[model samples]
Target: ELKVEQNPLFLSMQEGKNYTIYCNYSTTSDRLYWYRQDPGKSLESLFVLLSNGAVKQEGRLMASLDTKARLSTLHITAAVHDLSATYFCAVGGLTGGGNKLTFGTGTQLKVEL
Candidate 1:
């Protein structure tokens, strides 16, 4: 079984600062994904990186995947109070029938002004 790990499990940043969240996996994975969640709410898909060097960005969030390195990253640009949420990365578990998402520990970000 592959293990997914995320760094800086807890984050506190100013509203105008910038930061990056890191995600690493144990084994070979064909895909990488990022999601965001608010307290007691469902996850919102942020990015899905299916290939090496795949990158996606929206507003203050940006995600990228490097298959060869078995790593992914989520970057917050000019963090905002509204961006405070838990970010997660998921990888592997492709069983042909469907994808079983294995999520990371999750990074909790708090943007204080």
Candidate 2:
């Protein structure tokens, strides 16, 4: 079984602020991904961190990976109202004789004013 965890299950941020979301896994994984979901919408793939030190960014969001530590992070730069959403991190690896994605519980970010 694969287990993924994320910290700060809920976040209330103000515009022009910054924050980071952390993700940790119980087992080894070569793949980690970041996704965002708006209310009443489907999850949107934001970044795919495949190798160690892999980092990706777009707009106000940045994501990095550390395979050795089974940790990943999503950093929010200059938070804005439009950045409000639920973020998720999924760790993928061989499991049950196949590849599976273990998703974190998600961190809901609320940017106001």
Candidate 3:
């Protein structure tokens, strides 16, 4: 079975600060995905890391995956108020039926001025 967990379930920081969110999985995974969700909105895909050294960035957010260690990270640079949201990391594995995704406990980020 595959299980995913994230640290610092809630984060509160000031604008312009930098922080990194971690995701750890119990078993090997084929892909890692990062997502963001606002208080009352649907999830938005942020990054997809397929390989061990895969890294992707958008704006102030950067994501990386290490398949060997079954770990993924999401780094926020110069966090802004708009970045306040719930973040999640998901691990995808091949299942008997199809691909299965296991999501981590969400990290609620609150960026204040």
Over the stretch 1-113, how does candidate 2's per-residue lDDT look in tens digits?
67899998999989999999999999888799898999999999999988999999999899999999999999999998999999999998876897678899999999999
Candidate 2 colliding pairs? none
Each model's lDDT comes to 0.91, 0.93, 0.93
- Expressed as tens digits, the lDDT of each residue in 74-99 for candidate 3 is 99999999999999999998879976
Please give, for residues 6-112, the per-residue lDDT of candidate 1 as tens digits: 99899999988989999999998869889899999999988888999999999988998888889898999999999999999999677879988999999999999
- Candidate 3's displacement at residue 32, Å, is 0.2
Worst 10 residues of 3 by lDDT: 93-102
Clashes within 3 Å, all models in order:
0, 0, 0
Q: How well does candidate 2 match the true structure, expressed as C-alpha RMSD?
A: 1.5
How many times do residue backbones clash in model 1? Answer: 0
RMSD of each: 0.9, 1.5, 1.0
Clashing pairs in 3: none
User: Against the hidden true structure, what lDDT does model 2 obtain?
Assistant: 0.93
Q: What overall lDDT, based on C-alpha atoms, would model 1 receive against the true structure? A: 0.91
The parts of candidate 3 lying over 4 Å away from their true place are none
